[model samples]
Target: MASTRQIITDLRAQARALDGRHLSGSMMDGVCRSLRRGADELDRLLGELAMLRAFAEIPGDAE
Candidate 1:
């Protein structure tokens, strides 16, 4: 299981739960959107970092 996928899934679940709550106000909605955006950025950065690390594993200048 990719942790990035898990993180996204968890966040989506939490957002859904918040939507179901009686106090699901605009503030909470905005916060959730911001959190999702941040998570997305982190996920993108992680993918790039993974690729960079993988490339670094190659010996010499072939990488």
Candidate 2:
């Protein structure tokens, strides 16, 4: 599994990659879909990260 920070870094790179590309209409649509998926994935990962941190903060949990 990837760390949340690395996934965010990759998403930023993908956003940067969208610049200066000569994409056809369909290709641009596909790229937009991919970016949307990435955004959704990032949201999920962030949620999981938050949950993990919350769980970790609880005292006296079994190891």
Candidate 3:
């Protein structure tokens, strides 16, 4: 499985590509929509990973 950091990085790159587009109309709209979805998913995944890491770091349990 890919790490959260790598997933976020890939999503950001996709967003950049969508933003750089010179097209107009439905195609551009579709790309932007896809980019937004990817970004939101990445954000959720990163948040979950952060919570898991925090739980793992708590003192007193297995290291």
Candidate 2 achieves a global lDDT of: 0.65
How well does each candidate superpose onto the true structure, as a TM-score?
Answer: 0.57, 0.51, 0.52
lDDT of 1 by residue, 1-63 (tens): 457667777877777666534563445676577667877887788777677777877433231
Question: Arrange candidates by TM-score, highest first: which order?
Answer: 1, 3, 2
> Candidate 2: minimum summed lDDT over ten consecutive residues — where?
54-63
Residues forming the 10-long window of minimal summed lDDT in candidate 1: 18-27
How good is model 2 by TM-score? 0.51
lDDT of 1 at 44: 87
In terms of lDDT, model 1 sits at: 0.67
Those runs of model 3 whose alpha carbons end farther than 4 Å from true positions after fitting are 1-26, 58-63
Worst 10 residues of 3 by lDDT: 54-63
Clash tally for model 3: 0
**Candidate 2 clashes between residue pairs 3 or more apart in a chain or in different chains:** none
Off by over 4 Å in 1: 1-5, 20-27, 58-63
Model 3 over residues 7-53: C-alpha lDDT tens digits?
A: 76787777777775656443565676686788788788767766787
Q: lDDT for every model?
A: 0.67, 0.65, 0.68
Candidate 3's TM-score reads 0.52
